[model samples]
Target: MKKWQLQDIRIRDPFFLKENGEYYLYGTTDVNTWEGNGEGFDCYRSKDLKLFQGPYPVFRAPQNFWADRNFWAPEVWKYRGRYYMIASFKAEGRCRGVQVLISDDPRGPFVPVTDGPVTPTDWECLDGTLCFEDDGVYMVFCHEWIQTGDGCICAAKMSGDLTKLTGEPEVLFHASEAEWPVIHREFDSEGFVTDGPFLFRDENSRLHMIWSSYGEKGYAVGISHAQKGVIGKWNHERNTVLEKEGGHGMIFEGPEGRTLLVVHTPNTWLKERVKLYSVEKLILGG
Candidate 1:
C-alpha cells in the first residue's frame, strides 16, 4: 500500500473516526465536488494522523442508482455491530437528501440500506448525522438554505433498525438565529447558509453542537450549547471557534485520547486539505 502524507489528501467535510487502534478518515473525495458526475466515497487509514494509506473505495452508485450527481459528506457510525453511513445525495431533477448505507467493516464497501434518502422526499437536506439517546436514535441534518431562506438544523427519529425515518423532522434551529453567521450572498442571494451539524457532549454531559456558516471573515465554524438535550433550545457562542476561510468540522477523540476538531481549509476546490485543531485550545482556552 502506498502511504501518503495528510497534506497530500484533498477532501471536504472531513470526518475522522477512531476505531480499534487505527484512525479512519472519510469525506467528500471528488476532485471537483461542485459539478460533475458523482463519484463514490472513500476512506484512508493510519495508526498516526500524519500519514495514511489507501483511497479504499467504500461506496459506489450501483446500477439504477437514484442519484447521478452531488454525492456529499459521508459519515460512518458503528451501531449495533454494523457500520452505518449517513450521507447526502442528489440527482438533476430531485431534491437533495440524506441516505443511509451500511457495512460490516469500518473500511467498507458500504451499500445503501434504503432505496432513497431517509429525509423527506420533498425537502432539500444534507449532512445527516446520527445522534443516539436513551429515547431513541435521531438524525440531525441541515435543511438547505437554497430551499429555505434561513437554513435549519433539524432532527428526525429513526427506526431502531436504522432503516427509515419514523416521523417528520423537527427544526432544532436556523442559521439566522446565530449571531455570527451572515448571508452567503455569492452562493444564495437571500439565504443564511448552514453547512454541517455535528453533536457532541462536554465533560459535564451537557450537549453541544458545532456547525458552519459564513461569518465575518468567510466560511467559519461555531459551537452552540443545548439548553436541555439533543432537540432542546440551543444558544450560540456569539463568535466562531474557527474561521478565516474554513468550515464544516467534526470532533473526535484521537490518539492518546486527545479531543480534536477537523475541517477543510481555504474553502476552495482542490486546494482544500484537512486541518486539525485542539478542542481545548479552540473552545476552553486550555
Candidate 2:
C-alpha cells in the first residue's frame, strides 16, 4: 500500500466527511466507473486535505448482491450511532436506484440495510444523499435524465431508523428549471442531466442544494436556494458554482473550520481527480 497526495488519487463524485478531526474521502472508486463489474467502494483518510493514506476497502459486493455494475457515488452519513452509506447501483434488467448500507465504523464492511434501493425500484435514480430536517429524515436524490427526458431532483421521507423510505418521493425541482444547466444534447435534444443533489445551509440557515449538470463548459456544479424550507421551491443561481468541466461536488467544514467544496475535475474517465476549493472563494468569484 502507498500513501498518496490529493492529486495522486483518481476518483469521481468525491464525498468528504470529517469525523474526530480526521477527514474521510469516499467516491466512485471502481477502476471503470461507467461500466464493467462493480467491485465495491474504497475510502481514504487524511489529517489534512493535502495528503491521504489507504484505499481501505470499505465495501465489496456480496455473492447474493442483486446489482453487479454501476456502483456510484458512495457517501457516508453518521446518524443515530451508526454510519450509513447512501449509494447507487444498477443491473441489466433492473432500473438504477440508490440503496442504504450500514456499518458501525466509518471504515467497514458495510452491509445492506434496505433489501434494495430505498428509492422507487422502478425509477432510474442515483446520488441518494441523506438530509436531516426538524420534521424528519429525508433522502435527496436525482432521477436521472437517462430515463426521463428532463431529469429531476426529488426527496422522500425516510423511517426514523434510516432503513427504508416511508412515503412517496416528491419532486423538488427539475434540471430544466435551473437556469445554468445547458441541455445535454448528446444524450437527448431535450435532456437535462441531474446528478449529486447535496443539501446544505448558509449562515442564515436558508436551505440550499448543490447539484451537477451540463453547463456552458461541460459538466458544472450549481447551487439552488430553497424558498420555503428543505422541500420548498428552489431557485437556481444565475451562475454555476464551478464551471470548468468539474462537478458532482460535496461541501464540508475543513479541519480549520473553513467551508470547503470538493469536486472531481476534467470530468473525463480515468483523468478525473479531486479538486478542493474554498466555498467563499467560489461564491465570491461566481
Candidate 3:
C-alpha cells in the first residue's frame, strides 16, 4: 500500500522494460529471496524514469502453482503480440529452475503458460533470460553453483511460439571461466556463483551480457562480450562494469533515449533497492 523510491524498495535482480512509452520494473520482490514458498512477482510502472507508482501486483501464485517458494528474477519479454515472463522458482524436494508465464499486458495477473519449468528438472537453474536471432529464440540462464561446484551459464533453444523449450541446454560459460567474482565465503568459498544472466548489445551491435557475481567489492555486476554472435563465444571483461556491490542488472533505453543500467544497490539481505546508472555504450543503436 506504500509507494517506494528507487532507494526504498527492497528488491533484487532488477529488470526494466520500456514499452509504449511506459517503464515497467520487475524482479525478485521478496526480501528473503534465498528461501520461501515463493510469493508471486510484482511490477512498478512509470512514465518517466524519475517518479514511480504502484507495486502493482502483476503476479501472485495460484494454489496449484508448482513453485511453493523462492520465486525470483522475473523479466517480461514481448513477442508475437503478447508478453511472456521468464522467472526463477524453487520448491522443496525439487530443484530450482526457470519457468515461463504469460500475459497480454506488461502489468497483469500473469499466469503460468508452461506446465512447469523448461530447464532440466534435475538441475538447479535460475535467471532464465530470453534472446532471439534470425535462427530462433533461446533462453540464457544460470546453472547455479549450489548444484554444481562451478556455476555455468547455459543456452537452450526455445519453441517458436515461446511456450516450451525445444532442445538440450548448452553451456555458454562458468563462474570460474570469468575472472571477476570475488572469493567470498558468503557467496562461495570453494567455488564461484552465477546469478542473473541478461543479454544485450552495445552501439556497434556487439553482444554484451551483464550478470551478477561476488566481486572484489562483494556482490557486483560483471560484463561479458560475445566473440561471434548471440550464442557464440563470450569473453568476461577483466574489470567489472559495477564493482560496488548490487548487481543482477538489465539495460534498457530510458524515455530520454539515454542508455541506462538498472540494478539494485547494497546487495545486503533486506537492504537491496533499485539504482540506475547512465551507460549508453551498453545499449544498441537503431
Candidate 4:
C-alpha cells in the first residue's frame, strides 16, 4: 500500500469526518482549481490523519449538471441518519455557487438533492456550509466579492427536506465588516476577498464562526461570535483566530474528544498542505 501523503492530492477547501475510528477527507480535486476545471470531489480515509488511503471517486458530474467545473469544498454532515454535502461549483458563464448533495455513507456516491445551486442565482456565491438552528437548517455561505465590490457572508433557511431554499438570504456580515479582514495587493481592482464560512458552537454554548480572508501575511482565519446565537448579529473578534498562512477551516472532535481545526496551510496553490491544529478554549476577560 502506498503511504498516504498530502502531495497525492491537488485539493482545496478540505473538509473532514471522523467516523468509526477513521478520518475521511473530502475536497475539491483538480489539477488547477484557480482556472476552475475541477471534475468533482473525492474522499480519502486515514486512521491517523496521516497515511491516507483511497482517492475514492465519491461523486461524478451529472450529465445535465448545471456546473461543469470548479467543484469545491464538499463538506459532509450526518443529518437525520443520512449524509449531506454542501459544495461550491462554477459553470461556464455563471458565478460560483454552492449546491447541496446527498449520500448514504460518509465515503459516498453523492447525488444532487436540489435541482441546482442553492445560493442566489443572480449573485456570486461560494463556500456554503450547513448550520442547524432552532428554526431549521440554514445554508451559510460567502457572497463572492469578485462580482460585487464588497464581499459578504449570508445565511438562508432550507426547506424541510433540505432540497431547496425557503426564504431570502440574510446578510450575516461583510469582509469589510471585520477589523481583521484585510486586502493584500488589489485583485481585480477590488480590495477585498472573502472565502469559507464554517459554523461552530464552543463549549460555553456560544455560537462562533471561522472564515477566511486575505491579509498582508497571506490567507488567514478570523473568528466571530453571535451574542444572541443568531446569524444576522455576528460580532467580529478584534483578533484573528489563526493567522499563519492558512484559511478555510472546519472544526471536528477527534476520537479523544479534542476539538481540532482542519484547514489547508501555505495558502498558495503550489505549496498547499492539509494542516490540523488542536483548538484551545479561549477565555475572554474584561
Q: Quickly count the clashes in candidate 1.
A: 0
Instruction: Write model 3 residue lDDT over 90-130, tens digit each, in one string.
Output: 88999988899899999988999877898999999999999
Query: Candidate 3, after superposition: displacement of residue 87 in Å?
Result: 0.5
Writing each residue's lDDT as its tens digit, candidate 1 over 1-286 gives: 7798998888999997788988899999977677888989999999999989998999999998899888899999999999999999999999998999999999888998979988999999999998888899999999999899999999988999998989888999999999998887765356898989999988998898999999889999988989987877899898899877778899999878899999998799889999999999997782
Clashing pairs in 4: none
Model 2, backbone clash pairs (residues 3+ apart or across chains), number? 0
User: For model 2, how does the per-residue alpha-carbon lDDT over 1-286 read when each residue is reduced to its tens digit?
Assistant: 6799999999999998888889999999999887789999999999998889989999999888989999999999998889999999999999998989999999988999867888888899999998889999999999889888889999989999888889888999899897888778663345899999888888888788889999888899999989977777888898899887789999999976899889999899899999988988986456
Which candidate do you rate higher for lDDT, 1 or 2?
1
Question: Each model's TM-score, in the order given?
Answer: 0.98, 0.97, 0.93, 0.93
Candidate numbers sorted by TM-score from highest down: 1, 2, 3, 4
Q: Score candidate 1 by lDDT.
A: 0.90
What TM-score does prediction 4 earn? 0.93
Best by lDDT: 1
The per-prediction CA RMSD against the true structure, in angstroms, equals 1.1, 1.3, 2.5, 2.2
Q: What is the Å distance of residue 286 in model 1 from its true position?
A: 8.0
Best by the TM-score measure: 1
Q: List the residue pairs that clash in candidate 2.
A: none
lDDT of 4 by residue, 29-49 (tens): 666776755677778988877
